[model samples]
Target: MSDLPPPPRLPVTFRPGHTRAILLTAGVVIFLVISGIAMLLEHLGPGSRLSFILTGALIFWALAQLARVKVVADESGVTVVNIAGKRRLAWAEIVRVNLRPGDPWVFLDLSDGTSLPALGIQPGIAKQRAIADARALRALAEAHSASSALPHEPRS
Candidate 1:
């Protein structure tokens, strides 16, 4: 038998910062507040259908951006949240995890021969120490896999 290590297990409980969601949400809030004040002042009367419609649209868009993203792990496998939503995959189901520093996002390498969409790990998040943070997460995933006893043997 060949000696090999198993894949890493994702963090059982993890939540990525929803920066896009938050920003969009804040914009909606501010717009509504201003609109309300304008209407109260009679500056924006009831006939201001355009302003009302615009405000409603912004609120809806914010809600859409507010996606619940999380990564969960267990003895069985790991679950990932992508554009399609959350999906649970076993360790064997996970082909690889390629977390390269590009486009300010983290992409996952899957087993079925598909690349998972990038999750904004560093979306608009610029800092002198962001590199360190990104590396740490990659290391954590590697360590988790190592600790989980996931096999690393080549298939023939």
Candidate 2:
């Protein structure tokens, strides 16, 4: 059987493209509609109007968090940015990348025996893309750890 191609070059980033697009798009539409309704309500007082606008802003902010989730891989390590926080993990620290069936997103099994949720690679709207990204990341981690294990020859 033919071997799979090497992982993509470093400095690569994986994100849920469709998820982000939908979230941001929906946020904008919801915000606009909410703000418009607030302004159109002639009976509402200024305080209520401002509160309505603020509510819209808050909703947009919340959605922005999910839309910003991403996984970035560079020479040093991989950075996972989720809805609430970000974490950096060296290639050697990542023992495995898993995307099992019915999983909401990729999960990274670490050398420390911890499993981290990689929300950046969700199988929503694009299952194939998520699978490809997870495999590529797994390959990169394996390749990096293997290279690091090799003993270097002494300089002449």
Candidate 3:
């Protein structure tokens, strides 16, 4: 059998730029056309359209993870996130980096008694993204300080 964390159930691969697998491509295109017409008509402009606005907002949130979103896994534990804000936990401190299908975000339950979110691709685009992230996390944890912690350690 393979040694890796049994291979994340929903392994995903992330790409560069504003490339998001979760963003509903069809919906986005439709909204853009509608919003464009609304803007041309001066009906409070495209920004006033709720769907377009919401989609743009969600896209921005995903893109936020573009630069630093990375994943690393080793025998001990796995860490995934962008450097801007991150949660690093050793296996001892991790309950688990959940790999269930249909889960919203990659999660980390730290020894410090907190749950942090990882930058996981939306459901449709999880496999390649997860693999890429897992590789990065593995390398990082191996190179950096091993988190000296236990699974249920109390936070200071």
Candidate 4:
């Protein structure tokens, strides 16, 4: 067997709680189902049924998108998953992680002068918990960036 050690695993992952989103999504689905059933029983037209179903599906999709946003960090880099897209950046690419007072979410300052929002670390009723999590994320980013800046050894 080869003597090489296993690669280091990512220890930090940030994702918003799905409780509220799930409830909201479920409520939408239930409302749509009930409405559809009522319309069917009342012999409503196809247009009404289609409209109700489609609207509920759209709302549920949007809520699911909110629940899916996430930010994952490891020794190598960070990955951000947003409502519309996903991005991965190496440690050196990140300049800072900022979560200022009054801000709705955490923002990442990139080396190219672009800022990326981390929607997963949002400000809400659990203000203290969110702040604490942001601090921990910043520490992780700083540590990884510092280590990545060091000179690498040359292979013989």
Please report, in order, the local distance difference test score of every candidate based on alpha carbons: 0.54, 0.93, 0.49, 0.76
Candidate 3 structure quality by residue, lDDT tens digits, 1-156? 224432333233333223343334534555567556555665564457666657655655554445446454555555455537655456566544443566554555565778776664323344656545544443343333334432466799
Runs in model 3 deviating more than 4 A are 1-32, 39-96, 121-123, 142-156
Give a tens-digit lDDT track for model 1, residues 62-149: 5545445545566666666654577776665554554454555555666688876534344344432334434444455455556567
Q: Give the top-scoring candidate (TM-score).
A: 2
TM-score of every candidate: 0.56, 0.95, 0.40, 0.79
Clash number for each model = 7, 0, 20, 0
Q: Write the per-residue lDDT of candidate 4 for residues 1-156, one digit (tens) a residue.
A: 223233234667876665446646686777678566847765667887777777777777777776778788876788999889999988888898899999988999999999999887876756776777787777777667667778999999
Cα error, residue 133 of model 2, in Å, equals 0.6
lDDT of 3: 0.49
**Backbone clashes (count) for model 3:** 20
Q: Weakest 10 consecutive residues, lDDT, candidate 1? A: 1-10
What's the lDDT of the predicted structure labeled candidate 4? 0.76
Please give the RMSD of candidate 4 to the true structure: 6.7
Error of 2 at 71 (Å): 0.3
